[model samples]
Target: MDDQQFRQLLNRFGFSWSGYRKVRKGVKKRITKHMNALGCYNITTYLAELDKSDEVRKKCELLLTVSISRFFRDREFWKSLEKKYLPDLIDKNIEKINVWSAGCACGDEVYSFKIVWDCLRNSLGHLPKLEVIATDINPVYLEKACAGIYSSSSLKEVTEELQSTYFIKKKGKKRFEVNALLKKDVIWKTHHLLSDPPESKFDIIFLRNNVLTYYEDLLKKKAFRKILDSLAPYGFLIIGSHESLPFEPKDLIAIAPHSFVFRKEAE
Candidate 1:
């Protein structure tokens, strides 16, 4: 597609200019692949032909770029959560523990957190129903996540001891599946973080490596505001180690190294 057409197409999908810029190379490839999938070679012609087809739209959604994720992608954050964060939170008498894993591509992070939460619950001798709502804009990824299947590499971060306890190796080559216990805790759904409102206030919102780097300052601000607004009074906001807020406020406390968990001050 021509640059103008590409710009308009991304804008239609709520892609900010900065977001588009960051992913332009990937988008070009996606558009090219999309056209090929539709049996066309030219993007300009492809857009014109598919403009009226919702089927094309769905295919295009599948073609959008994404990076692969492995379980326990960041080990230190998981460690901190286990050693420090979870203990404090479990002491509370909350009725439900809601964790919203936004941009939860392929459910690795969702499953990882679920594993930790289950371990904590078992250790404490009481298990509260964990309502973990895993969301991503892409339907394809969500489908894969709900299936609870993974390649062997997804468990690379898990130590042999934990892996033995949490995963059962399948008969096929390069295959494994989550133990039935962890499978019970997660609910996967398609959600557009850019446009949709927070479905519920959460005790923890795990929005890692994906959000901040893609958008421009204005869009980033908008996302940060959405995240802040989505959190419960004492909810924690855990982001990737490479990410940080543009401006720090007293309400957002840096509890562990490189982890900023926000809590609304008690009135």
Candidate 2:
């Protein structure tokens, strides 16, 4: 598809072009693959087919929503959470913790959080009720996440200690499967950030790379507002290192220097 046609397709699905320019080549390649799979000889035919079939259009949307993810993606971010944030949160709410991994692709981030929690719990000599909710817009990703198996490349950031502790090497395969204990507490579901309101107050919400960086200003703000609404008093919000809030919401305070971590001010 040409630039205009691709942009039109994305626009129809409520995606903006803020960061589309940089990823245009990759997006076009994906579109071409989808078109070929659908037996369309040209962009014109594909567009016509896309207009007629909801299933095809949904597949196109999934293709455009890139699902690149890895465990402990920005290592420093997780370190900051372990050494700085979690301690304070634990002090305040020692009995329970609620964490939401927004845009959690294939379960890496969710499992990462559990690994950190396991270490912290061992050090503290107490176990709190940890409820982790991982959500993504794509059903295929959710399915993969539920399986809890990952390629070696996706586990690169995971330390040797963590890998040995939490994952078992798949027999005769170059992949790792998360241990049953780690997977037990996590709840995976399909969710859209823009339209769905928060189901419950969360102690910490990880709204990293994709949701904030990929969309336009208006949608970003809308999603941000919903995120803020979901955070409990004195709760934390984590975003991608390269991401910034579209507009600062009132009473949200940055917790560290040059960090995407912020805490909701208690009313």
Candidate 3:
């Protein structure tokens, strides 16, 4: 598929052209294969198939998805999460801390958070319970996440100490699997961020590198509002380090030392 055909597909899904432009070549290759499978010779026929068949459209959306993540992506953010934010939440004396790793592709960020939480137990005894809801739009990714195995490259950002503590290397393989201990109590589900949140407030919601990165303004703003609303008062909303909020929200305050970390204003 050429750029024009790719743009048509992005428009059909309300996806951002700029967002897909950089990665469209790979995405188009996948879509083109899908089109050939359906015997669609051109964009027009593929578009028609998408319109009439819910199954085809769903598959197409999965093709359009871009999941490029690693453990402890953006080192500063994880440092802040561990040294500052998690500690502050602990000091609040809340008995339970709820976390939502939205668009949690392949569970890297979710497991990374769990590892940090586990580390805190070493320094601070008797910490509150952590409830993590990890969601992604693609069930295929969720399935892999459930398996808790990751490529060596995905663990590049992880320190040697962390690697020794949390992951067990597969025998003679470059991949590592998260310890079963870290996988427990994580809720993994297939979810579209454009829809309502998981019917629960969050102490910290990791909304990094998906919606704000790949959606058009209208969809981005709408989804951003939903994510914001689901954050409990004073709860944190962490976006991609390079991403900007679609609009200046009145109730969100940027945390010091990091522009990407925002705390919901107390109601």
Candidate 4:
């Protein structure tokens, strides 16, 4: 599909053209493959097919997904999580800590948090019981997440010591598998950001690089509000470093200027 055709598909689904612009080449390829699979000769035919079937539309959305992530993606942000925000969170919530990894692609972000938490625990003795909910709309990504294996490229930001501590290298393979220890207390679910959040209030919600990056303003605001509502008092909401909120939310205050970390102020 061409840029104009892709933009039409994105507009119909409330996705952002600017957000997908840089990565549209690969996404367009995926959509074109999907179109061919559906026996569509052109964008007009594909759009009609998408309108006629809910499943077709959903499949198209999946095809549009850009799953570009790596462990400790924003290294500075991860440092803040490890040295600053999380330490404060533990000080307040001495009993249990709940975290949500929204749009957790292939578990990289979720496992990154777990690694940080683990390192923190070892340094400061036992921490509060931790529970993490990692959600994404794509089941294929979740399956890869559950498997816990990753390519060397995905571990680029991961330091040697951290890598040794958290992952197991397979024989004759360049892939690394996340240690089983990090997998515990993590619940992987197929969830849409537009839907209601998981049952519990979260101490930390990683909404990075997804809703705010992909969706239009209306959908971004709607989903952002739901995410804000799910944050516990004084909880932190982390968005992609390059992303910004669709509108100013009175309840959230920016904690870090360089990174997109915001803290929920008490209501």
Task: Assess every candidate by TM-score.
Answer: 0.82, 0.91, 0.98, 0.98
Q: Give the distance in Å from residue 79's predicted Cα in candidate 1 to where it truly belongs.
A: 0.8
lDDT of candidate 1 over 148-200, digit per residue (tens): 78887788898888888888787856777788878786788877666664678
Task: Identify the superior model by lDDT, candidate 3 or candidate 4.
Answer: 3
lDDT: the better of candidates 1 and 3: 3
Best by lDDT: 3
Candidate 3 residue lDDT tens string, 27-76: 98999999999999999999999999999999999999998999999998
Q: Which structure is stronger by TM-score: 2 or 3?
A: 3
Worst 10 residues of 1 by lDDT: 258-267
TM-score of 4: 0.98
Residue-by-residue lDDT tens digits, candidate 2, 236-266 = 9999888999888888898776469899998
The stretch of ten residues in a row with the least summed lDDT in candidate 2 is 12-21
Better of 1 and 3 by TM-score: 3
Ranking by TM-score: 3, 4, 2, 1
Model 2, CA-based lDDT: 0.86
Report the alpha-carbon TM-score of model 1 versus the true structure: 0.82
